[model samples]
Target: MNDTSRNVSFTDPWIYCLDHGYVTPMICQSTEVLCFLLGTPALVWCLWISLSGSISGGLKPTQIFPMNLCIVELLFCIEGLFQTIYYLFLPNNNMFLQVVYCLFFIAWVCRPLFQTCICVERYMAVVQPVAFIKYRLRRYRMGTSTLIWGLAIIYPCFTVSSLGYLTKTNDVLVSVYCLGGVVISFCCFFILRALKQPGPGEVEGGRGGEKKQRTTDPQKMRAFSIVLTNLVIILVSSILVAVGFFTMPNSGIDFYCNTFLMLLACNMLSVVVSPVLHLHREGRLHCRKGPVTN
Candidate 1:
C-alpha cells in the first residue's frame, strides 16, 4: 500500500508541479539576466581580437584556426546574450520564445561542431604535414570552413525539422533526450582516434647529434587536452541532464537542480570556456599583440 501511494504521488501532475514550484519564472528571468550581463563584454573582446589580425604571422594556418574558433565562440556568445534577454524579458510570448529557443539550440550545438573541426585541423597539421601545407592556402581554408559550417547547420536543422514534430509524445521526448548520447559517443570515438595516432615530430629524430626522444608533440598534446576538456564538460553535463529527466518521477528536487546546473554548465562551455581555451592556447591572454600568433 505504501509503495502504491508513493507511485501515485510520483505520477500526479499536481505533485510534480508542487515539487518544482520553487523554481519560479521570476528566478529564471533573473538568472538569464545575470548570464547576459556577464557574457556580452567577453564576446565583444573576443571579436575585437579576431578582427585586429595582428597575430597573423609564422604558421598562419595554425594561428587562423584558433581565430576562427574564437569567431565562432563570439557569435555564439552574442546569440546567447540575446537569448537570455529574450527569455528574461518576454517569457510569456510563446512565438518569440520558440524562435529564441531555436537560435539558442543552433548556437549551442554549433560551438562543439566548430571545435571538433578545429581539432581535426590541428590533427592534420601535426599528422599530415605535406597535405596540410598543400591545403594551407587561404582559399582552401575558407572553403573548408564554409563546408563545415554548412554541414553543422544542415544536420541539426534537418533533425529538428523532422524530429520536432514528434516531440509532443512522451516516447519522443525520451528519444530526444538520447540525442546527447549519440553526440557524446561520436566525439569520444574521434578524439580517441586522434590521440592514438603518432604526431609529426615523433617519427623524426631532432638532429644528428641530438638524442632520439619519445616526447609528445606540444601542439598535439594541446589539441588532445582541449578536446578532452570539452568532452568531459559536455559528457558530465549531458549525463546530469539525462539523469534529471529520467529520474524526475522519483525525486523532483534533484531533477530540477541537476537540470538547471547542467544547462548552466553547457551554456558556460559555449559562451565562456571555448573562447578562453582558444585564447590561452594561442597565448593571447597577456600579450598586447592583439591575438595569439600561431
Candidate 2:
C-alpha cells in the first residue's frame, strides 16, 4: 500500500471497514462514476445560468456570487470527472494520490469560505441597508471576492506545508474548520430571523384580501431569504464533513471505506448544489431593469 493512503482510503481494495464503513474498490469506482454523472449536468446548467444571469441588470451585483460558486463547482466537476477516469484507466499511476488530495482539500475549503463571504455581505445589506446601498456593491464585491480567494489559495500552502506529503489529519482539520464556519453561518441565520420579526407594515392581507400592505422591509426580507438558503447549504456540507471526520478510516478497514468514499464524492457536490439552490431561490427576482439584485 502507498504511504499517502492508509487502511480505509482509495488505496484499500477490499470490502468493509469497521470505522469508515463499507467501500471496496468496486464501491469507490462506482461512487466516482455517479459523481461524474451528476456533476456533468450540474456543470452545464451552472455555466449557462451564470453566463446568462449577468445580462439581467438587477442580477449584476448579486450574480457575481452565484456565478462564482457555479464556476468553482464546474471546476470541481471536472476534477471529479478526471478522477473517475484516472481510477478506471490509470490504475498504475499511484504516485498522484497526494496531488488529488491536495486539489480536493483546496476545493472543499473554498466551498464554505465563499458561502461565508456571501452570508457576511448579506448581513451588511440587512443590518446596515443605507451603508450597503450608498457604498456601492460592485467595488466591494470585487475586493471581497479577491480577498476570499486569496485566503483560500494560500490556505493549502500552510496545510500541506511539506509539499509532497498528505496526511489524514489534514482532512480532519478541514472538517473542523468547516464546522466552525457552519456555526458562524447559523448565527447569521438567527440574526436574519430576528430582523424578520413582525413589525409595523409587516402584515399583508386579511381573509377577504383587504387593502392591507405587505412586508416590513422587502429588501431586508429578500436578504434574509438569500442568507437562509446559503445557511442551509452550509449546514449540510459542514455536517457531511463532520461525519467524514468522525468516521475516518483510522480503525476498521471495510466499514470505513464508505464514509471515505462519500467524503470524496461530496467534495464535488457543494459546487453543484449551491448554484442550483441559489437559482431556485432568486432566479425570478433578477429583473433586467431594477437595481442590481443581491
Candidate 3:
C-alpha cells in the first residue's frame, strides 16, 4: 500500500480539494477553442476592411469605433489562444497562468467600454448631428480612443493592490455595463423620436389636389434599429454578469466552473456578434442571388 501510494503521488503531485480537479481547465479549453474558431475569421476580415477603407479615405470618424472593437476582439482571441495553449502544455506553470489572466482581464474590461463608445458615436451622429460635426474631428476620436485604451491598461494594475481579489475590478465592470446600458437606452429613445419626425424634403406639396405625406429618413430608421440592437445586446450581457456575481458564493465546484465558462462564452459571443452587426452597417456583408436562369 505504501509503495502504491508513493507511485500515485509521484505521478500526480498537484493537490486539489475539488471532486474533479480537471473540470475547470477542460471547460476553459473548450470555450477558448470555440472563441478562437468563431472570432478569428470575422475579426480578421473586419480589420482588413477597416484598414483598406481608411487607406482609401473612405472610412468615417464613426467607423473608427468599430475598428477599435475589432482590436478588442483580436485581443480577446489572442488571450483565449494563449490560455488554451498554456493550459494544454504547461498547466502547472503559475507564471504563465498569471500572464494569461492579465491578458484575459484586460480584454474582458475593454470589450464593454468599446461597445459603449461605438453606441455613443452613433448616438451623436443620429441624435445631434450638428454637434457631432465639430466633435467628429480626427483628433477628437483619436484622443477618446487613446483614453479608453489607457484606462483599460491602467485598470488591471489595481489587481496587485487588491491582493488578486478583483473586487474593485468587478465593481468597475458592473458600473461600466450599467452605464453602457443607460447610454444605449438613451440613444434608442432619441432615435425613435427622430424616426417618427419628417425630414426637410419628406413633405410633398398638397396644393395641386395632392395628398400631403410624411416620410422618415431611411438613414434615421437604420440608426434606430442599430441602437435598439445594441441595447438588447448590452442588457443581455449585463444580466449574465449580474447572475454570475450574485450566485458565486456557496456554489459547488461544477457550478463555479460552469459559471465562469458561461461568462467566457458570453464574452466571446458578444465579440463575434458585435462585429457582424458593424460589418452590416459598414456595407461589408450582403446577400445577392446568382443571375436568373433563362
Candidate 4:
C-alpha cells in the first residue's frame, strides 16, 4: 500500500506539484524529453557556427549581439537540461533546489537583456541607418553592448534563488509587453529596410524616362530573413514565458501549452545563431548591398 501510494503521489497532479515546486505532471515528461533532445543539438550546432564566425572575422557589431545571445542560450539550455534530469532521477534536496533556481533565474533574466540588445542594434542598422553610422563613429555600439553585458551580469544578482523574481504577476506582465513590443519593432525595421527606396545613384530611366523599381540585394534579403527568423523564434519563447509565469487556467490544454512553452524556452535562443550560420554557409550576409554602412 505504501509503494502504491507513493507511486500515485509521484504521478498525481495535486500532490506532485506540492512536493516538487517547479515540476509538472508525469504526462509532461515526454514533452520535456522531446524539447531537450531535439533542441539541444540544434542549439549546439548553432553555437559552433556562431563561435566559428566570431573567431574568423572578429566580432562585428551585429555579430557581437548574436554571439552574446548564443552564449546566454547555451547557459539556459545547460541549466534546463539538468533540471529535467534532476526532476526525473534525483530526490528533491533543498540544496539542489536552490541551485536550480539560481541557474534558471540567471538564464531567465539575462536572456532578455541580450535579446533586447539585438533588437535595438538591428533597428538602428536597418531602420535608422544615418543614426547607426553616427553611433558607430562615436563607438556608441561598443558602449551600448558593454552596458548590456554589465546589466545581464548584474540583474541576476538580486533574483538568484528567489521565487518572486520571475513569478510576480507584475514582472511577468511587463516582460510580456516589452517582449511583444520588441517583436513588433523588429518586424517594422525589416519591412522598412526591405522597402527602402533605391540610392540616388541607382535611379534610372527604363523606356520613356520612367524611374525603374529596384529590387533589394539578395545578400541583404538573406540577412533580413535570418534576423526576422530569429526574432520570430525568440518572440514565441517569450510568449511561452509569459504564460508560464502567470497564473493560467487548470484545464488540460492550458497545462500542455504551458509545459511546451517551458520546454521550448530552454533553448529557443538557438535561433540567434542560425542567421550567422546561414551567413557563413552563403559566404556572406544574404543581402547584396550590406546594411552596415559607415
Candidate 5:
C-alpha cells in the first residue's frame, strides 16, 4: 500500500487526517455533496431551458447572450460536481489530480467574467438600443461571442501560468484560491455602471408645441430591477470572498467554511435564481394558463 503517513502533519490537521487514513470532515464532505446535488439539478434545468427555446422566447438574438451564459454556468457546475466527487473519493491522485482541480478552478473563475459580459449586453440593449440592434446581426453576435469566450479563457490561462500561485502551506492542507480580484472588481464596477444607465430608446415628445419626453417602460424598469438584485448578490459574494481571504486566519474551520460556502453559493445562486427571476419577469411561471410573451 502507498505510505499514507507522509500525507499527515501537525501543521495541517485536515491533510494529516487524510494522510493518516481518516475520512475528510463530515461537514466538508456533506457540503460538497450537497453542492454537487444542487448543482446537477440546476445545470439540467438550465440546459433544458436553453434547448427548449422557451426560456427566452424562441432564441431571439438578444436572448442568445444570456443563453450562452447559461451554458457556461451549466458546464462549470457540472465540472464542479465531478471535482467534488473526486476530492471526496480519491484524494490522493497527485499531479494529474492537481491539474484536473486547476481546470475546475479556471471554469469557476471564468464564470463571473462571462456574467459581466452579459450585463454589458443588457446595458447596451437598454442604453444604446440602436447600437444593440445593429450588433444583433448574426455575424456580429457570433463574432463578439467568440471573442468574449476566447478572451475569458486566454486571460485566465495566462494568469494561472504566470502570476497566479497555488500551494499547500506548512500546515499541509490544500486550498485552491486564485488572484483575480482586480479583474472581478473591474467587472463589478462596469456592471454597476451599466445597471445605472437609463433604459433604451428614451425620446422627448410633448403635446402641442412642447416635446414629450421619452422614458423607460415600467415593465422594463422592473426587469432592470431584477437584474440589479442579482448583480448585488454577486458583488456582495465576491467582496465577502475577498475579505475572508485577507482578514481571516488561514486553516481555520470558520475560514474554510465561509470561503468555500461563499463561492459555492455565488455559483449556485446565478444558476438557480437567474432563470427563475427571468421567468417571473416574463410571466412564464403562469404558462399553464397560457404562454407568456416576452
Candidate 6:
C-alpha cells in the first residue's frame, strides 16, 4: 500500500509539485530530448556558416550579436542534451544535477540580455546611423558582450546550492525580461517609423536621394524583420516568465511542465529563426546587388 501510494503521489501533479518543488523529471527530460533533437543541427549549421564568413574576412558589427546569440543557444542546447542523458541513467534528483540545472538559468538570463543588445544594435543602425557609425568599433561590442557573459556566468555561480538566492535571482531576471520586451518592442516601432521617413541626405537632395533610399528599401525591410522577430521572441519569453512566476507556486506539476516546455519552445524557435534570418541576410537563400548601407 505504501509503495502504491508513493507511486500515485509521484505521478500526481499537485502532490509531486509539493514534494519536489520542480517538474517531474521524466516529463521534463523527455521535453528536453525533444528540444535537443530539434535545435542542435540547425544551430550548428548556422554557427558554422556564420563563422566562416566572419572569420575569413572580419566580423561585421551586424554579425556580432547574432553570433553571440548562436553561441548562447548552442550552450543551452548542449546543457539540455546533457541533462537528458543524465536523467536517462539516474532518473533522480541529486546535488550534481541541481548544479547542472543552474546552467539553464544562466542561459535564460543571458538570452534576454544578449537579445536586448541585438535590438539596441539594430535600432542604432537603422534609426541613428551617424551614432552607430561613430561607436561602431568591435571593442565596444566586445566589451559589452564580455560584461554580459561574465555577469550571467558569475551570478548563477555564486547562487549555487541556494534556492533562496536562485529565487531572488529569477525575480530580478523576470523584471529584466519584462524590460527587454519593452525595449525590443520600441526598437521595432522606431525601425518601422524609420522605414517611412527620408534620411537627412534624402531631405537635402530631394528626389535623387529619395530614389537612392528606395533602392535600399529591401535592406531596411530586412532590418525591420530582424527587430520584429526579436520583439516577438522576447515578448513570448516574457509572458512565459510572468506565467511561471505567478503560477508555479500554487500550481501543479503540469503547469511547471507546460511552462518549461514553452520556454524551450522559444529556444527552439530562436534556433530555427536565427539561422533562417542569417541565411536570408547572407543572400544564401536570396540574391543581393549591393551591401546594406545607410
Instruction: Give the number of the best model, judged by TM-score.
Output: 3
| After superposition, candidate 2 runs with Cα above 4 Å error | 1-31, 55-59, 94-99, 134-136, 151-164, 168-176, 203-229, 246-249, 263-271, 278-294
Instruction: Give the range of the ten consecutive residues with the poorest summed lDDT in model 2.
Output: 12-21
1-294: candidate 2 lDDT, tens digit per residue? 642355444343432232234435455556556656766675676667667756664467755765665656655665565666665566466546545555565566556666666665566665666876885567777777787667656665565545423445456456655665765566686667767776656777776977466666777677676666666666766776666655654544433454555565564455556555544554533432323456
For 54-101, candidate 5 gives per-residue lDDT tens digits of 645655666566666766766665665665656667666655455554
Question: How well is each residue in 1-294 modelled by candidate 3, as lDDT tens digits?
Answer: 332122111112212212345465466567678768877887898899778878898767777777887888899988989977775688787677667767866787777777777767777876798988879987787888899888887766556345634555556666776676677677767766776677778877698957588676666666567667777877787677655554443344445554545674675677678767666666666663322222
Error of 1 at 174 (Å): 11
Superposed on all Cα atoms, model 5 deviates from the true structure by an RMSD in Å of 7.4
Off by over 4 Å in 3: 1-28, 203-212, 246-254, 280-294
Task: Give Cα distance to truth, residue 262, candidate 6, Å.
Answer: 4.6
Residues 106-217, model 4: lDDT tens digits? 5666677667766776677667789888775435556766775676556555655456453343364447446755665665566556545465555666888787766566
Q: What is the lDDT of every predicted structure here? A: 0.53, 0.59, 0.68, 0.56, 0.53, 0.66
lDDT of 6: 0.66
lDDT rank order:
3, 6, 2, 4, 1, 5
Evaluate candidate 4 by giving its C-alpha RMSD to the native, one decimal: 7.0
Whole-structure CA lDDT of model 3:
0.68
Error of 3 at 106 (Å): 1.5
- Local error of candidate 4 at residue 66 (angstroms): 1.1
Which candidate order results from sorting by TM-score in descending order?
Answer: 3, 6, 2, 4, 5, 1
TM-score of 1: 0.57
Weakest 10 consecutive residues, lDDT, candidate 1?
3-12
Best by lDDT: 3
Give the Cα error of residue 108 in candidate 1, in Å. Answer: 2.1
